[model samples]
Target chain A: MKKLINSPDSVIADALRGMAAAHPALSVDHDTRVISRAGGAAQGKVGLVSGGGSGHEPLHGGYVGPGMLDAAVPGEIYTSPVPDQILAATKAADGGAGVLHIVKNYTGDVLNFRMAAELAEDEDIRVSAVVMNDDTAVEDSTFTAGRRGTGATVVAEKIAGAAAAQGADLDAVTRLVTEVNDRSRSFGIALHAGTVPAAGTPGFELGPDEVELGVGIHGEPGRERGSMAPVRDLVAYALEAINADRPVGGDVLVLLNGQGGTPLIELYGAYAEAVDWLEGHGATVTRNLVGNYITSLDQAGFSITVTALDDELVRLWDAPVETPALRWGR
Target chain B: MKKLINSPDSVIADALRGMAAAHPALSVDHDTRVISRAGGAAQGKVGLVSGGGSGHEPLHGGYVGPGMLDAAVPGEIYTSPVPDQILAATKAADGGAGVLHIVKNYTGDVLNFRMAAELAEDEDIRVSAVVMNDDTAVEDSTFTAGRRGTGATVVAEKIAGAAAAQGADLDAVTRLVTEVNDRSRSFGIALHAGTVPAAGTPGFELGPDEVELGVGIHGEPGRERGSMAPVRDLVAYALEAINADRPVGGDVLVLLNGQGGTPLIELYGAYAEAVDWLEGHGATVTRNLVGNYITSLDQAGFSITVTALDDELVRLWDAPVETPALRWGR
Candidate 1:
């Protein structure tokens, strides 16, 4: 693969170095692969921690800052961080109140984070965990037993992190994160698969005229393959799947995320279709984000994430967030 | 081409619809294809107007906000906007203090913006223009009379837009934009060419192990084509080009821009090398932006821009900007 990396093995380390240089507000622990706030966790607030593979950037790591993740533990590309790495992040984030782990639903990630949580508990640290499985694309995937977590992970990190930053206790923060995940749904489509640097080839291939519907972030098999269609139709299919599973309505927050290689022009185009679909179906979009948040390496695709929102969720989302990936107000 | 668009012919319109849906702070005029501040231009503030082809998203249109452009006129993909559209934007942006046009160095863009300035003059709207030609790759190329403008356009917009928002007159805004362009230098390398939707194919081609160095945003030929190497070598080559054209030293604001398809992970990795190169070369990076700010559709590449900063420029660079692509502070 023609990637801008020194080597496949050094990708995460190199990127962390860059992040540390670019964002002085966040500190990178190169040895442990934990990105945490430069000022350290607040003394009385519950610390927010999230992590996963390295490919989906601006996810766990880029979200670290005030009003967001306190620490992010990144593993190898598409590979879950080991228990040691997660434990390091957990300890770094703990501020005496407690630590909340926001994890995506993947077998490796779930197990690793759980193991880390257990390890943290052995040290007398109270830790609460929320596993996100918002992807409606499939019930199981190559690395997941339940629905693969996708775009909703960003929503969860932001909303729940806001609550944690506002002095919520570990239990309240955990409940908010769980609620965000429960009210969220995501679906993805791929025009092309992302190539792993080590593999030097795309994980899968697509015919010139075909598209993968409901594709997972790691190039896992989706529900089915379909012929190429207009963005409106593609968005409709994604929304239909989400509606079938959750029946979206009322005030909602939306994320039209571009898989790595998709252009912002196309993301905006697709976002228009999503907004049209949502408003036509009686849902009022109160807040929206259109760009790459959780990307799958260099995959060319897009994911639609919808979160049914209440007044409190909306307020939290609008609250100041200072992170590399998602920042506003502050 | 596998793009998330309705049709090649409807790409701009559809994307505009999506932009309107996604950003409530901006107003999009479908008929004129102009994006402007939703709350209208501030009275007595020098209005900033910038525009060009459509594909390089978040450049002209996305920069329209409180601290950036007052209006942006977008043309068809890779095609310069018509004088009428530019004139409309100029008129829309005109406050009592006059307007400034930030034009890239493409031949068509310069000519169109010039003509629009003339039209605005006929309508009694004073307009000043600054043409950016910061690419140090080549003196002249396919669509440019001199050097082609690349990544420095975003720097010019942010710094100069801040001046305009601070109530700088049109002349001062124009001068500051010109200074930004003069102090800045950029170079790009592409692993693959971006495919224009209308063309249905890549603008250019590269062998599996080759890369196009100093490539233009429109896929125009660059300085040379060379075999693929590590990102360090590639970044060194780009910085070398910039340093050769204009010696880089002292405080510098750097932008490591992704050419559409490059992942944020890779961009960050590349950024590390850039920071190392700049520091090693006796330049201190006072500010930096790493992401896809200016893009060329779905091309796999990156461009590095370094602007030598003085105290005033640094202050303006640190000013609040709220745009779809580049945002920080208030």
Candidate 2:
């Protein structure tokens, strides 16, 4: 388990220090390990915030920007950011217009973020949060965490960021984010496993000939294990699961997401396969995306999310967002 | 050397068939092996095109949409799409507005795209290209492929996708894309190599106690091997390389790219280290992106890309884009 770090425990602290030094425009709350812009966004603008385990790059922290999140709380790799860190983010993002916290649906993430929100309220800072539970891998399942929040986090952040950037009030931004999550559904698969730097080993053992289906981000075992098949069959399985959980509206914002290890070529191949299935089914893919957006550490696989889009949501979706992870029309 | 396919020779063809089945909105030319939207965007709009190997999913193909790219040519995993495929893309994207090819900086990508561009000229379709040679890992030397492009491919795609979406002329779009390539630099590090499905073997070897520095997308050997250090130092090495190569400019767009297998959490961990280094150097991380954008199949590593930005290009970049890969800003 050789890695680029002096010690597993010190990786996060040292990284925070380095980020603080490298980007003068970004200010790091060393005490809390929260990252925000130097002066934070303007006052009177609803502050948008997001936080989670630190492994997903450009997600919580990389997304801290002008048209996006005001600040983000980062936890250690595959670990939740502490309650205190979340509180710090809520406070920094509070611009008198209130704050909205975007959280992915993971047990630790939910608990930690919710606790942070509670702590923020105690501080007299009006903070509202929305949990993104869009992974559609299963329903009424036991053995694992309920449908994991896979790809919807990206949409939530973008839409919420846009609303916040437009000066939408906290309630409005929170509602918008929730609405997007409500309209989104996701399903995932993994070909290989990634290592938790702290654990110093691969998350799971995957025979070279098999891929884990419906795997969670933390290397949670997938729903099924099967021989890797042609891309079309994989698309069929992913779409069947995602489409089954399709939001009521029919119009969908499709996301073909790569788990940590899959390559871009494979992602596109899968996306092409997924879209073909949707089109053949007489379904319309109103908006679509493909890439390694929200990823499980280094698992080799991908997921798909379809967020049904409405005119208002689509407009907000098109709004410029400037984050390290996503920047276009910014 | 474990993979699911029946045979390595069948990978590309099988993948394409699967892609066609999944993405009906995309027309896959079996003969030419090109993937294009079923219907082109505005007829007079300059068409945006890009592509490379099969494993970098969602890249050239997933980017095909309203405000991004019109067509993406794909090759075998980690292999350049042949000249014929590039020609197919050129034809499919040849609306009256001409075409702009966004190519990553690879020896094969360069040779193949250039040859296709020459072929397009013979057909009277005006074609321009911007070769994205952003990786600074391999310094100028006779022993290398001259800086291989890494993460800047995303920046070039997004910005040029915007300009083309805004009805910018082919030349203008091409120029902007080239400028971005010129101003950007990238560096990568890998902990472990991925198994190429086609090759049925690891792309490269890494000792348990070491990692590779300055690697490319084809699983190419990096500049050197060294004992793993703190994530911060690795990031510094990358940022320093990118920063040194970066042209003097205003804001900078930085990308924390995971090679195929590095998990998002690890990518973020790497980001924490890299961004800190970037900030300390007085670089304004105006736009930050962290994810697996450009990748080598399933290699466990990450790369950093920084592109200097100015207001105009930034504004153009802020324009709405809705691709299968990047769908946030519609």
Report the C-alpha displacement of residue B64, candidate 1, in angstroms: 0.7
- Give the runs in model 1 whose Cα sits over 4 Å from its true position: none
Q: TM-score for model 1?
A: 0.99
Candidate number achieving the greatest DockQ relative to the actual structure: 1
TM-score of each: 0.99, 0.75
lDDT of each residue in A15-130, candidate 2, tens digit only = 66646644566788888788997887678998887878866655677677767788988888877888988888888888888888888777788888888888888888888888
Q: Indicate which candidate wins on TM-score.
A: 1
Residue-wise lDDT of candidate 1 within B1-330, one digit each (tens)? 788989999999999999998898899999989899998878899988999998998787988887788899998998999999999898888887898999999999999999999999999999899999999998999989999998888999998888987878888888899999999999999999999999999999899999999999999999899999999999999999999989999999999999999999999999999999999999999899999999999999999999999999999988998988777894
Clashes of each: 0, 47
Q: Write the per-residue lDDT of candidate 2 for residues B78-132, one digit (tens) a residue.
A: 7788998898899898888898888776778889999999999999989888877
How would you encode candidate 1's per-residue C-alpha lDDT over A1-330 as one tens digit per residue?
Answer: 688989988998899999999999998999999999999878988988999998999888999998889999989999999999999998899999999988899999999999999999999989999999999999988899988888888999998889987888999989998899999999999999999899999989999999999999999989999989999999999999999999989999999999999999999999999999999999999899999999999999999999999999999999998898888984
Model 2 C-alpha lDDT versus the unseen true structure = 0.74
Report the lDDT of model 2 for residue B39.
Answer: 84
